[model samples]
Target: MSKQHEKLRMMLTAALFAAIIGIMAQVTIPLPLVPITGQTLAVGLAATILGSRYGALSAIIYMLLGAVGIPVFSGMSAGMGVIFGPTGGYIVSFIFSAFITGLYIEKTSATVTQAFIANAIGMLINLTFGTVWLKVMADLSWAEAFVGGFTPFIIGGILKAFLAAWIGILARKRLQSARLLPSSTKLSA
Candidate 1:
């Protein structure tokens, strides 16, 4: 493909992943503090497939959409209020999670094992950021934050990480075979 076409394809793919994150954010299981959502899964998948640059681009686009009142956040909430709200840390963490996850896989290989490790780290980052933000924003003690925002999501996070790893690697391999995805080196370039 021409360079222009490749760039356009990557851009469109990032946009599509951004939409996927928005849609996944609606899969919420409510809790006292943070709700469980599929946003992290989508984040993992994007990074595993697109690597650091496009993956982080997808997250940035997703956040920008929500920040501008696009109703793309959890519970369909939008605007800067959601970005600066109690749950905003989780939202903000997606960028780092995606970037780091993709960077890990890029530096290594897009194998299931590497992806799982990367996703697990991403999950930890997400949880840590969210818990601390919840504590500060909600004026809760660390214990309360751990209980309300951290502990409840551990099991679910693990499952999501594994799922993202398995599914992401599988899909990435298929896309590469079909020439729909560029190689990691090409992506970095």
Candidate 2:
């Protein structure tokens, strides 16, 4: 593909990923601090598929859209206030999680095991950011923050990570078979 075409493809991919994240945010299970949303899966998939820069860009786009009052966030809420709310940390975490996960997948190449590792690490980063943000935002103790936010989502997060990793592996296989992705050596470099 020509340079222009490649750029267009990347932009399209980023938009698609952003849309997926936005849609996933709408699918939520209510909880105390932050609700459970399918966004983690979307983030993992974006990272696995698009690599670091594009994955991060996609997340940035999602945040920007939500911040601009698109109601793309969980509970269909938006604005800078949301970013500073209890769930704000989780939102911020998406950027790092996608970037790190994508970097891991891109460097190691996507395999079931590698995807699992990447997703796990990425989720950890998310939790870290989220928990800290929640504590500060809500003025809660560590235990309270854990109970209100992190603890409730552990099992779900694991399951989602596994699911995302599995899907990522399958997608990678399909892309490779279809010659959509570059070879491993080229991707690694």
Candidate 3:
């Protein structure tokens, strides 16, 4: 494909992944402090498939949409209020999580194992930021934060990581085969 065409494709794909993250954010299981949502999984998938640059772009687009009151956040919540709310840390961390996850994949390969490790690390990053933010934003003790933010999500995070890894790697391979994605060199571009 032409260079211009490839760039367009990447931009469109990033937008699409942003939409996917918004949609997935609706898959929420309510909790006292931070609800478990599919947002992290979507972030992982974006990273694994789109690589660092586009993956981070997808997260940035998602955040911008939510900040602008697009109702794209979990529970259909939107606005800068959500961005500054107790759960805001997770939202902000999505950009970093996607970038790091994609960076790991780009540095190695998009195999399931590598993706799983990368996603797991991303999950930790999400939980850490979220827990700390929850503690401060919610005025909770460290134990409370650990219980409400960290402990409850560990198993679920692992499952989501594995799922993201498996599904992301599979989808990425198909996208590459269909010529919907650029070559490895272009992935980091």
Candidate 4:
């Protein structure tokens, strides 16, 4: 493909991925403060597939849409205030999670198992930021914060990570077959 065509394809793909992530957020199984949603899985998958720049741009696009009052967040909530709310930290963490995961996946060599591990680390980053924000907002101790905001999501996160990694592997293979990715960009785990 031409350079312009490739750039356009990447942009459109990023936007589509952001939209998918937003949709996944709405298919939530509510907990207490934080809901169990497939958004993290989508985020990880986008990162793994799109690379760091595009992945982070996709997340930023999602956040911007939500900030503009798009009903894209969990429970269909949106706007700047919602982002600054108790769960805001988690939303913000998506940017870093996507960026870090993409960076690692792009730079390091990793198998499916290693990719899953990277996904887990990314989720932990989200939990850490989210738990801290929850503590401040809820005025709870660390233990309380963890129980309320992080613990309940552990199983779901693990499941999502595994799924994301698996999907990533599949997508990578397909891309390789299609010659979408240059061999020089390959990473080994």
Candidate 5:
């Protein structure tokens, strides 16, 4: 495909991934600090499949949609209140998580093991950012923040990270082999 075609494909893919993240957000076990949702899994998948810049762009799009009062969040909630709420840190952290995960996977040629590690690191970043935000925004103590926001989600995060790495690498390899996705297409300035 021509570079122009490739660029359009990337943009569409990013939008699709953003929607996927939004849909996944609906699968939530509502909690106090942060809802247990499939969002992190989708984030991992987007990063591995879309690469760093595109994955991060997709996350930004998702946030923008939510901020605009779109019912794209857990339990179909939306608006600026959600974006600036106690759990908003996790939402904001998604971009960095996707970017870091994608960068690591791209650099390692999307190796499965490294992908898992990268996703795990991304999860840690999310957990840390979300916890701090919870503490600051909610006026909770550090221990309370960690317990409520971080500790509660540890196992679920690991599972989602692993699933994202496994599924994303497989899908990416398939797309690459099909000539549907280029291996190294960075956005032009």
Candidate 6:
């Protein structure tokens, strides 16, 4: 594809991923404070497949949509209130998580294991930021925050990370074969 065409393809890919994230956010398991959601998995996949810049852009788009009162956050909730609420930290951390995951994939040879580790690290980042935010926002003790924000999500986070890595690698290959992926990054199978 020509350079212009490739750029358009990338833009579209990023937007599509952002929309995917929005759609996935609706799939949530209601819990106290931070609900279990598919947002993490979507963020991980977008980052691993789109690379750093596009991945971060995708997450930013998602955040902006939610910020603008779009029903993109969990439980069809949106607006600045949700973001500033106890769970807001996790939403904000999605951008960093995407960038981190994509950076790891692009900087090194993208592999399933590497993708998993990168996403796992991103999850930890989210958890730490979210836990601290929850503590301050809810005026809870460390142990209380841990239980409310971190403990319940640990196993689910690991599973989501693994799924993101496995499916992201597989999807990357398929996209490359279909020439749907931009030819800029080195994501050959």
The candidate that wins on lDDT is 3
Tens digits of per-residue lDDT, candidate 6, 1-189, equal 677777778778888998999999999999867789899999999988888878888999999999999999999999999888889999999999898888888887678999899889889988988899899888899999999999899899999999999999888878887888865455322
Error of 2 at 51 (Å): 1.2
- lDDT tens digits by residue: candidate 5, 1-189: 788898888888999999999999999897866789999999999998888888898999999999998998877989999878899999999999999998887777677788899899999999999899999999999999999999999999999999998999899889888877886533321
- The TM-score measured for candidate 5 stands at 0.95
lDDT digits (tens) for residues 1-189 of candidate 2: 565665576677788899999999989988756789998889888887777787888999999999999998998889999998888999889999999988888788578888888999999899888998999999999999988888888888888889888997788678767766544512321
Candidate 5 overall Cα lDDT vs. reference?
A: 0.88
lDDT of each prediction vs. the true structure?
A: 0.90, 0.84, 0.92, 0.82, 0.88, 0.87
- Scored by Cα lDDT, where does model 1 land? 0.90
* TM-score, structure 3 vs. true: 0.97
Model 1 worst lDDT window (10 residues): 180-189
Q: Once superposed on the true structure, which residue ranges of model 3 sit more than 4 Å away at CA? A: none
Better of 1 and 5 by TM-score: 1
Candidate 3 residue-wise lDDT, 167-187, digit = tens: 999999999888899856239
Q: State the lDDT at 71 in candidate 4.
A: 89
Q: State how far residue 156 of model 1 sits from its true place (Å).
A: 0.7
Candidate 1, residues 1-189: lDDT per residue as tens digits? 887887889889999999999999999999878899999999999988888889989999999999999999999999998888889999999999999998988888778999999999999999999999989998999999999999999999999999999999999888888888875532742
Q: Candidate 4 on 96-115: residue-level lDDT in tens?
A: 99888877777775457767
After superposition, candidate 5 runs with Cα above 4 Å error = 185-189
TM-scores of the candidates are: 0.96, 0.93, 0.97, 0.91, 0.95, 0.94
In lDDT terms, how accurate is model 2? 0.84
